[model samples]
Target: MSIWEFANPRKFTALSLKILPTLVGLSAVLVLGGLIWGFAFTPNADKFESTVKIIYVHVPSALMAINGWLMMLVCSLIWLVRRHHVSALAARAAAPVGVVMTVIALFTGAVWGQPMWGTWWVWDPRLTSFLILFLFYLGYMALWAAIEDTETAADLTSILCLVGSVFALLSRYAVNFWNQGLHQGTSIPVATGGRTVADVYFLPLVVAMAGFFVLFVALVLARTVTLIRERRLAVLDAQEARA
Candidate 1:
Protein backbone atom coordinates (compact mmCIF):
# COMPACT_ATOMS: atom_id res chain seq x y z
CA MET A 1 0.00 0.00 0.00
CA SER A 2 2.31 2.70 1.29
CA ILE A 3 5.54 3.07 -0.66
CA TRP A 4 7.26 2.75 2.70
CA GLU A 5 6.49 -0.94 2.61
CA PHE A 6 9.54 -1.35 0.47
CA ALA A 7 11.63 0.15 3.25
CA ASN A 8 11.22 -3.05 5.19
CA PRO A 9 14.38 -5.09 4.75
CA ARG A 10 12.67 -8.33 3.80
CA LYS A 11 10.37 -6.68 1.32
CA PHE A 12 13.16 -4.63 -0.17
CA THR A 13 15.45 -7.62 -0.44
CA ALA A 14 12.86 -9.80 -2.14
CA LEU A 15 11.78 -7.14 -4.58
CA SER A 16 15.32 -6.10 -5.39
CA LEU A 17 16.37 -9.70 -5.99
CA LYS A 18 13.67 -10.08 -8.60
CA ILE A 19 14.33 -6.78 -10.39
CA LEU A 20 18.08 -6.23 -10.12
CA PRO A 21 19.06 -8.99 -12.55
CA THR A 22 16.74 -7.65 -15.22
CA LEU A 23 18.02 -4.14 -14.65
CA VAL A 24 21.61 -5.28 -14.89
CA GLY A 25 21.04 -7.25 -18.08
CA LEU A 26 19.12 -4.42 -19.72
CA SER A 27 21.73 -1.84 -18.76
CA ALA A 28 24.58 -3.93 -20.11
CA VAL A 29 22.81 -4.50 -23.41
CA LEU A 30 21.77 -0.90 -23.88
CA VAL A 31 25.05 0.65 -22.80
CA LEU A 32 27.14 -1.68 -24.90
CA GLY A 33 24.85 -1.40 -27.91
CA GLY A 34 24.52 2.38 -27.69
CA LEU A 35 28.24 2.87 -27.38
CA ILE A 36 28.98 0.55 -30.30
CA TRP A 37 26.40 2.31 -32.45
CA GLY A 38 27.69 5.74 -31.57
CA PHE A 39 31.27 4.81 -32.27
CA ALA A 40 30.88 2.58 -35.30
CA PHE A 41 27.74 3.74 -37.05
CA THR A 42 27.45 7.47 -36.38
CA PRO A 43 29.42 9.74 -38.63
CA ASN A 44 31.75 12.41 -37.33
CA ALA A 45 30.30 15.88 -36.97
CA ASP A 46 31.81 18.61 -39.12
CA LYS A 47 32.47 20.66 -36.01
CA PHE A 48 33.55 18.19 -33.35
CA GLU A 49 34.57 15.46 -35.78
CA SER A 50 35.63 12.21 -34.14
CA THR A 51 35.55 13.79 -30.72
CA VAL A 52 31.76 13.85 -30.98
CA LYS A 53 31.63 10.13 -30.32
CA ILE A 54 32.59 10.73 -26.70
CA ILE A 55 29.12 12.10 -26.09
CA TYR A 56 27.77 8.58 -25.89
CA VAL A 57 29.65 8.10 -22.64
CA HIS A 58 30.16 11.73 -21.62
CA VAL A 59 26.57 12.91 -21.62
CA PRO A 60 25.25 9.86 -19.84
CA SER A 61 28.03 10.00 -17.25
CA ALA A 62 27.35 13.67 -16.67
CA LEU A 63 23.62 13.03 -16.25
CA MET A 64 24.28 10.26 -13.73
CA ALA A 65 26.84 12.42 -11.97
CA ILE A 66 24.19 15.02 -11.18
CA ASN A 67 21.30 12.63 -10.64
CA GLY A 68 23.33 10.45 -8.24
CA TRP A 69 23.88 13.39 -5.92
CA LEU A 70 20.22 14.36 -6.13
CA MET A 71 19.26 10.81 -5.24
CA MET A 72 21.49 10.93 -2.15
CA LEU A 73 20.00 14.24 -1.09
CA VAL A 74 16.49 12.88 -1.33
CA CYS A 75 17.39 9.66 0.48
CA SER A 76 19.17 11.61 3.18
CA LEU A 77 16.11 13.77 3.71
CA ILE A 78 13.89 10.74 3.98
CA TRP A 79 16.24 9.15 6.51
CA LEU A 80 16.26 12.27 8.63
CA VAL A 81 12.52 12.76 8.49
CA ARG A 82 11.20 9.24 8.55
CA ARG A 83 14.17 7.48 10.18
CA HIS A 84 14.29 4.85 7.48
CA HIS A 85 17.35 2.63 7.61
CA VAL A 86 16.98 1.87 3.92
CA SER A 87 16.98 5.57 3.16
CA ALA A 88 20.21 6.12 5.07
CA LEU A 89 21.92 3.12 3.49
CA ALA A 90 20.68 4.18 0.09
CA ALA A 91 22.36 7.54 0.54
CA ARG A 92 25.55 5.79 1.53
CA ALA A 93 25.25 3.47 -1.44
CA ALA A 94 24.92 6.39 -3.83
CA ALA A 95 28.01 8.33 -2.77
CA PRO A 96 30.71 6.23 -4.42
CA VAL A 97 28.72 5.98 -7.63
CA GLY A 98 28.27 9.73 -7.67
CA VAL A 99 31.96 10.29 -7.08
CA VAL A 100 32.96 7.90 -9.86
CA MET A 101 30.50 9.49 -12.29
CA THR A 102 31.73 12.97 -11.39
CA VAL A 103 35.28 11.92 -12.06
CA ILE A 104 34.29 10.35 -15.38
CA ALA A 105 32.45 13.48 -16.44
CA LEU A 106 35.36 15.70 -15.49
CA PHE A 107 37.86 13.42 -17.17
CA THR A 108 35.83 13.18 -20.35
CA GLY A 109 35.17 16.90 -20.33
CA ALA A 110 38.88 17.51 -20.08
CA VAL A 111 39.50 15.12 -22.94
CA TRP A 112 36.83 16.85 -25.00
CA GLY A 113 38.02 20.31 -23.99
CA GLN A 114 41.69 19.87 -24.84
CA PRO A 115 41.15 19.99 -28.60
CA MET A 116 38.32 22.51 -28.35
CA TRP A 117 39.37 24.82 -25.52
CA GLY A 118 43.14 24.31 -25.79
CA THR A 119 43.19 23.67 -22.05
CA TRP A 120 42.79 20.68 -19.77
CA TRP A 121 41.10 22.52 -16.94
CA VAL A 122 39.67 25.90 -15.91
CA TRP A 123 37.97 27.58 -12.99
CA ASP A 124 34.88 28.40 -14.97
CA PRO A 125 31.76 28.53 -12.80
CA ARG A 126 30.35 25.21 -14.00
CA LEU A 127 33.64 23.36 -13.74
CA THR A 128 34.41 24.89 -10.34
CA SER A 129 31.02 23.95 -8.93
CA PHE A 130 31.33 20.45 -10.33
CA LEU A 131 34.71 20.06 -8.68
CA ILE A 132 33.20 21.30 -5.45
CA LEU A 133 30.52 18.67 -5.79
CA PHE A 134 33.17 15.96 -6.13
CA LEU A 135 34.86 17.26 -3.01
CA PHE A 136 31.54 17.18 -1.17
CA TYR A 137 31.08 13.54 -2.14
CA LEU A 138 34.47 12.71 -0.70
CA GLY A 139 33.80 14.64 2.46
CA TYR A 140 30.37 13.06 2.95
CA MET A 141 31.78 9.55 2.60
CA ALA A 142 34.80 10.32 4.73
CA LEU A 143 32.61 11.72 7.50
CA TRP A 144 30.50 8.60 7.41
CA ALA A 145 33.58 6.40 7.67
CA ALA A 146 34.92 8.42 10.58
CA ILE A 147 31.89 8.01 12.77
CA GLU A 148 31.67 4.72 14.64
CA ASP A 149 27.96 4.69 15.40
CA THR A 150 25.80 3.85 12.39
CA GLU A 151 23.01 6.18 13.40
CA THR A 152 25.44 8.99 14.12
CA ALA A 153 27.11 8.44 10.76
CA ALA A 154 23.79 8.67 9.01
CA ASP A 155 22.77 11.83 10.87
CA LEU A 156 26.08 13.56 10.27
CA THR A 157 26.30 12.52 6.63
CA SER A 158 22.74 13.70 6.06
CA ILE A 159 23.65 17.15 7.34
CA LEU A 160 26.74 17.18 5.16
CA CYS A 161 24.52 16.30 2.20
CA LEU A 162 22.27 19.28 2.97
CA VAL A 163 25.26 21.59 3.08
CA GLY A 164 26.75 20.27 -0.14
CA SER A 165 23.38 20.63 -1.91
CA VAL A 166 23.91 24.34 -2.33
CA PHE A 167 26.97 23.67 -4.47
CA ALA A 168 25.15 20.92 -6.39
CA LEU A 169 22.33 23.30 -7.27
CA LEU A 170 24.88 25.88 -8.35
CA SER A 171 26.68 23.27 -10.44
CA ARG A 172 23.51 22.49 -12.39
CA TYR A 173 22.57 26.09 -13.19
CA ALA A 174 25.95 27.75 -13.20
CA VAL A 175 26.16 27.28 -16.97
CA ASN A 176 23.05 29.40 -17.36
CA PHE A 177 23.91 32.08 -14.79
CA TRP A 178 27.46 32.49 -16.09
CA ASN A 179 27.67 31.64 -19.74
CA GLN A 180 31.31 32.70 -20.08
CA GLY A 181 32.64 29.15 -19.83
CA LEU A 182 34.54 27.38 -22.55
CA HIS A 183 31.85 24.70 -22.48
CA GLN A 184 29.03 25.00 -25.00
CA GLY A 185 25.42 25.66 -24.00
CA THR A 186 22.89 22.87 -23.35
CA SER A 187 22.08 20.76 -26.44
CA ILE A 188 20.09 17.73 -25.32
CA PRO A 189 16.62 19.16 -25.68
CA VAL A 190 17.12 19.26 -29.51
CA ALA A 191 15.06 22.49 -29.59
CA THR A 192 17.36 24.36 -27.20
CA GLY A 193 20.21 22.62 -28.99
CA GLY A 194 20.21 25.39 -31.63
CA ARG A 195 20.12 22.62 -34.26
CA THR A 196 23.86 22.27 -33.73
CA VAL A 197 24.05 18.46 -33.91
CA ALA A 198 22.51 16.07 -36.41
CA ASP A 199 19.49 13.91 -35.62
CA VAL A 200 21.50 10.76 -36.26
CA TYR A 201 23.44 11.34 -33.03
CA PHE A 202 20.34 11.68 -30.87
CA LEU A 203 19.11 8.08 -30.82
CA PRO A 204 22.30 6.51 -29.48
CA LEU A 205 22.73 9.28 -26.95
CA VAL A 206 19.20 8.68 -25.68
CA VAL A 207 19.83 4.96 -25.36
CA ALA A 208 23.11 5.59 -23.59
CA MET A 209 21.45 7.92 -21.11
CA ALA A 210 18.75 5.37 -20.38
CA GLY A 211 21.30 2.60 -19.93
CA PHE A 212 23.46 4.59 -17.55
CA PHE A 213 20.40 5.61 -15.56
CA VAL A 214 19.36 2.01 -15.13
CA LEU A 215 22.91 1.01 -14.23
CA PHE A 216 23.04 3.67 -11.57
CA VAL A 217 19.80 2.43 -10.06
CA ALA A 218 21.01 -1.17 -10.09
CA LEU A 219 24.26 -0.28 -8.37
CA VAL A 220 22.49 1.67 -5.65
CA LEU A 221 20.07 -1.14 -4.99
CA ALA A 222 22.81 -3.74 -4.83
CA ARG A 223 24.90 -1.66 -2.45
CA THR A 224 21.91 -0.91 -0.27
CA VAL A 225 21.18 -4.61 0.06
CA THR A 226 24.75 -5.30 1.11
CA LEU A 227 24.62 -2.54 3.70
CA ILE A 228 21.32 -3.79 5.08
CA ARG A 229 22.68 -7.32 5.35
CA GLU A 230 25.77 -6.07 7.12
CA ARG A 231 23.60 -4.13 9.56
CA ARG A 232 21.44 -7.17 10.17
CA LEU A 233 24.49 -9.31 10.86
CA ALA A 234 25.81 -6.77 13.33
CA VAL A 235 22.50 -6.82 15.18
CA LEU A 236 22.61 -10.59 15.31
CA ASP A 237 26.15 -10.55 16.62
CA ALA A 238 25.21 -8.09 19.36
CA GLN A 239 22.31 -10.29 20.38
CA GLU A 240 24.59 -13.35 20.48
CA ALA A 241 27.00 -11.46 22.72
CA ARG A 242 24.17 -10.62 25.16
CA ALA A 243 22.86 -14.22 25.03
Candidate 2:
Protein backbone atom coordinates (compact mmCIF):
# COMPACT_ATOMS: atom_id res chain seq x y z
CA MET A 1 0.00 0.00 0.00
CA SER A 2 0.99 3.63 -0.45
CA ILE A 3 2.50 5.50 2.46
CA TRP A 4 -0.61 7.67 2.75
CA GLU A 5 -2.72 4.73 3.85
CA PHE A 6 -0.85 4.68 7.13
CA ALA A 7 -1.81 8.30 7.77
CA ASN A 8 -5.28 7.27 8.84
CA PRO A 9 -5.59 7.90 12.57
CA ARG A 10 -7.02 4.49 13.35
CA LYS A 11 -4.33 2.67 11.42
CA PHE A 12 -1.58 4.84 12.79
CA THR A 13 -2.84 4.51 16.33
CA ALA A 14 -2.97 0.74 16.13
CA LEU A 15 0.49 0.52 14.64
CA SER A 16 1.87 2.89 17.23
CA LEU A 17 0.29 1.02 20.10
CA LYS A 18 1.83 -2.23 18.86
CA ILE A 19 5.28 -0.69 18.47
CA LEU A 20 5.40 1.75 21.38
CA PRO A 21 6.40 -0.67 24.11
CA THR A 22 9.19 -2.19 22.06
CA LEU A 23 10.45 1.19 21.01
CA VAL A 24 10.52 2.52 24.56
CA GLY A 25 12.27 -0.54 25.92
CA LEU A 26 14.91 -0.60 23.21
CA SER A 27 15.51 3.15 23.50
CA ALA A 28 16.12 2.95 27.23
CA VAL A 29 18.49 0.03 26.87
CA LEU A 30 20.47 1.56 24.04
CA VAL A 31 20.77 5.01 25.60
CA LEU A 32 21.91 3.67 28.94
CA GLY A 33 24.32 1.21 27.37
CA GLY A 34 25.68 3.86 25.10
CA LEU A 35 26.25 6.28 27.98
CA ILE A 36 27.96 3.67 30.09
CA TRP A 37 30.23 2.68 27.24
CA GLY A 38 30.94 6.22 26.20
CA PHE A 39 31.67 7.68 29.64
CA ALA A 40 33.26 4.81 31.52
CA PHE A 41 34.99 2.68 28.92
CA THR A 42 36.01 5.03 26.15
CA PRO A 43 39.60 6.17 26.31
CA ASN A 44 40.42 9.86 26.50
CA ALA A 45 41.57 11.53 23.33
CA ASP A 46 45.20 12.48 23.02
CA LYS A 47 44.17 15.96 21.98
CA PHE A 48 41.04 16.78 23.97
CA GLU A 49 41.14 13.99 26.58
CA SER A 50 37.84 12.93 28.12
CA THR A 51 36.16 16.08 26.83
CA VAL A 52 35.98 14.46 23.42
CA LYS A 53 33.45 12.01 24.85
CA ILE A 54 30.89 14.73 24.49
CA ILE A 55 30.79 13.75 20.83
CA TYR A 56 28.57 10.84 21.84
CA VAL A 57 25.79 13.26 22.62
CA HIS A 58 26.70 16.39 20.71
CA VAL A 59 27.16 14.90 17.26
CA PRO A 60 24.13 12.65 17.36
CA SER A 61 21.90 15.43 18.71
CA ALA A 62 23.11 17.80 16.03
CA LEU A 63 22.49 15.25 13.31
CA MET A 64 19.01 14.50 14.66
CA ALA A 65 18.18 18.19 14.84
CA ILE A 66 18.69 18.40 11.10
CA ASN A 67 16.92 15.12 10.40
CA GLY A 68 13.91 16.23 12.47
CA TRP A 69 13.61 19.41 10.45
CA LEU A 70 13.76 17.45 7.21
CA MET A 71 10.98 15.18 8.44
CA MET A 72 8.86 18.24 9.21
CA LEU A 73 9.54 19.62 5.76
CA VAL A 74 8.28 16.41 4.20
CA CYS A 75 5.19 16.39 6.42
CA SER A 76 4.49 20.00 5.63
CA LEU A 77 4.74 19.31 1.93
CA ILE A 78 2.33 16.39 2.23
CA TRP A 79 -0.11 18.52 4.22
CA LEU A 80 -0.01 21.38 1.78
CA VAL A 81 -0.50 19.21 -1.26
CA ARG A 82 -2.97 16.64 0.07
CA ARG A 83 -4.74 18.66 2.77
CA HIS A 84 -4.15 15.70 5.05
CA HIS A 85 -4.85 16.57 8.67
CA VAL A 86 -2.51 13.89 9.99
CA SER A 87 0.32 15.25 7.89
CA ALA A 88 -0.10 18.69 9.40
CA LEU A 89 -0.39 17.25 12.89
CA ALA A 90 2.80 15.23 12.38
CA ALA A 91 4.62 18.37 11.33
CA ARG A 92 3.35 20.19 14.41
CA ALA A 93 4.25 17.27 16.62
CA ALA A 94 7.82 17.25 15.30
CA ALA A 95 8.63 20.95 15.87
CA PRO A 96 9.16 20.92 19.64
CA VAL A 97 11.26 17.78 19.47
CA GLY A 98 13.42 19.30 16.75
CA VAL A 99 13.87 22.44 18.82
CA VAL A 100 14.84 20.47 21.91
CA MET A 101 17.42 18.45 19.95
CA THR A 102 18.86 21.63 18.49
CA VAL A 103 19.16 23.13 21.95
CA ILE A 104 20.89 20.03 23.28
CA ALA A 105 23.35 20.09 20.40
CA LEU A 106 24.15 23.78 20.90
CA PHE A 107 24.43 23.43 24.66
CA THR A 108 26.67 20.39 24.54
CA GLY A 109 28.76 21.89 21.77
CA ALA A 110 29.37 25.00 23.88
CA VAL A 111 30.42 22.88 26.82
CA TRP A 112 32.76 20.83 24.65
CA GLY A 113 34.12 23.89 22.89
CA GLN A 114 35.01 25.88 26.00
CA PRO A 115 38.07 23.83 26.95
CA MET A 116 38.97 23.05 23.34
CA TRP A 117 38.28 26.26 21.48
CA GLY A 118 38.73 28.63 24.48
CA THR A 119 35.33 30.16 23.76
CA TRP A 120 31.76 29.10 24.36
CA TRP A 121 30.38 30.97 21.35
CA VAL A 122 31.42 31.94 17.86
CA TRP A 123 30.02 33.72 14.80
CA ASP A 124 31.34 31.03 12.50
CA PRO A 125 29.10 30.09 9.60
CA ARG A 126 28.04 26.69 10.94
CA LEU A 127 27.36 27.94 14.45
CA THR A 128 25.58 31.08 13.29
CA SER A 129 23.36 29.26 10.83
CA PHE A 130 22.43 26.69 13.46
CA LEU A 131 21.32 29.52 15.74
CA ILE A 132 19.19 30.83 12.90
CA LEU A 133 17.68 27.36 12.51
CA PHE A 134 16.67 27.43 16.16
CA LEU A 135 15.02 30.79 15.60
CA PHE A 136 13.16 29.48 12.57
CA TYR A 137 11.87 26.56 14.61
CA LEU A 138 10.64 28.91 17.32
CA GLY A 139 8.95 31.19 14.78
CA TYR A 140 7.26 28.29 13.04
CA MET A 141 5.85 27.04 16.34
CA ALA A 142 4.75 30.52 17.34
CA LEU A 143 2.98 31.03 14.03
CA TRP A 144 1.01 27.86 14.62
CA ALA A 145 0.14 28.94 18.17
CA ALA A 146 -0.90 32.45 17.13
CA ILE A 147 -3.50 31.22 14.68
CA GLU A 148 -6.85 29.88 15.89
CA ASP A 149 -7.80 28.20 12.66
CA THR A 150 -5.99 24.93 12.13
CA GLU A 151 -6.03 25.06 8.32
CA THR A 152 -4.59 28.54 8.27
CA ALA A 153 -1.90 27.58 10.75
CA ALA A 154 -0.92 24.59 8.62
CA ASP A 155 -0.64 26.68 5.45
CA LEU A 156 1.41 29.39 7.09
CA THR A 157 3.70 26.95 8.84
CA SER A 158 4.22 25.01 5.61
CA ILE A 159 5.38 28.16 3.88
CA LEU A 160 7.70 28.97 6.75
CA CYS A 161 9.14 25.46 6.74
CA LEU A 162 9.86 25.64 3.04
CA VAL A 163 11.53 29.01 3.42
CA GLY A 164 13.57 27.78 6.38
CA SER A 165 14.89 24.87 4.32
CA VAL A 166 17.46 27.20 2.79
CA PHE A 167 18.89 28.06 6.19
CA ALA A 168 19.03 24.39 7.12
CA LEU A 169 21.06 23.66 4.03
CA LEU A 170 23.35 26.54 4.85
CA SER A 171 23.82 25.23 8.39
CA ARG A 172 25.01 21.87 7.10
CA TYR A 173 27.35 23.19 4.46
CA ALA A 174 28.59 26.29 6.26
CA VAL A 175 32.07 24.96 7.00
CA ASN A 176 32.62 24.07 3.35
CA PHE A 177 31.22 27.41 2.18
CA TRP A 178 33.26 29.58 4.54
CA ASN A 179 36.31 27.38 5.28
CA GLN A 180 36.52 28.73 8.84
CA GLY A 181 36.53 27.49 12.44
CA LEU A 182 38.63 25.25 14.71
CA HIS A 183 36.30 22.34 14.13
CA GLN A 184 38.34 19.41 12.94
CA GLY A 185 37.96 17.96 9.48
CA THR A 186 35.53 15.10 9.04
CA SER A 187 36.88 11.53 9.36
CA ILE A 188 35.25 8.23 10.11
CA PRO A 189 36.92 5.31 11.85
CA VAL A 190 37.63 2.39 9.44
CA ALA A 191 37.15 4.63 6.41
CA THR A 192 40.01 5.72 4.15
CA GLY A 193 42.05 8.52 5.72
CA GLY A 194 39.96 8.24 8.94
CA ARG A 195 41.12 9.54 12.28
CA THR A 196 42.64 6.76 14.35
CA VAL A 197 40.54 7.22 17.45
CA ALA A 198 40.91 4.20 19.73
CA ASP A 199 38.40 1.38 19.35
CA VAL A 200 37.51 1.81 23.02
CA TYR A 201 36.38 5.31 22.13
CA PHE A 202 34.90 4.52 18.74
CA LEU A 203 32.46 1.78 19.84
CA PRO A 204 30.71 3.94 22.39
CA LEU A 205 30.27 6.78 19.93
CA VAL A 206 28.57 4.38 17.57
CA VAL A 207 26.30 3.04 20.33
CA ALA A 208 25.36 6.53 21.43
CA MET A 209 24.45 7.54 17.90
CA ALA A 210 22.21 4.49 17.58
CA GLY A 211 20.57 5.19 20.94
CA PHE A 212 19.75 8.76 20.04
CA PHE A 213 18.17 7.67 16.78
CA VAL A 214 15.93 5.24 18.66
CA LEU A 215 14.96 7.89 21.17
CA PHE A 216 14.10 10.34 18.43
CA VAL A 217 11.93 7.85 16.60
CA ALA A 218 10.06 6.94 19.77
CA LEU A 219 9.39 10.57 20.61
CA VAL A 220 8.08 11.37 17.13
CA LEU A 221 5.81 8.35 17.01
CA ALA A 222 4.41 9.04 20.49
CA ARG A 223 3.81 12.70 19.73
CA THR A 224 2.15 11.91 16.41
CA VAL A 225 -0.19 9.45 18.13
CA THR A 226 -1.14 12.05 20.75
CA LEU A 227 -1.82 14.65 18.08
CA ILE A 228 -3.98 12.21 16.15
CA ARG A 229 -6.05 11.40 19.23
CA GLU A 230 -6.56 15.07 20.10
CA ARG A 231 -7.70 15.83 16.57
CA ARG A 232 -10.13 12.95 16.62
CA LEU A 233 -11.61 14.18 19.89
CA ALA A 234 -11.94 17.70 18.53
CA VAL A 235 -13.81 16.45 15.49
CA LEU A 236 -16.20 14.47 17.67
CA ASP A 237 -16.85 17.49 19.85
CA ALA A 238 -17.61 19.61 16.80
CA GLN A 239 -20.10 17.06 15.47
CA GLU A 240 -21.83 16.90 18.83
CA ALA A 241 -22.11 20.69 18.90
CA ARG A 242 -23.64 20.64 15.41
CA ALA A 243 -26.20 18.02 16.50
Clashes of each: 0, 0
Q: Which candidate leads in TM-score?
A: 1
Candidates in order have lDDT scores of 0.90, 0.86
Clashing pairs in 1: none
lDDT of 2 by residue, 41-113 (tens): 7778888888977988887788788888888899999999888888888889889989999999999989998
Candidate 1: Cα lDDT at 128: 92
Quote the positional error of residue 188 for candidate 2 in Å.
3.4
Which number leads on lDDT? 1
TM per candidate comes to 0.96, 0.93
* Candidate 1, residue 63: lDDT: 84
Write model 1 residue lDDT over 1-243, tens digit each, in one string.
999999898999898999999999999998998899999999988888999999998889988988898899999999999999899999999999989999999999999989988999989988898899999999999998999999999999999999998888888778777968777656764446555556799888888889999999999999999999999999999999999
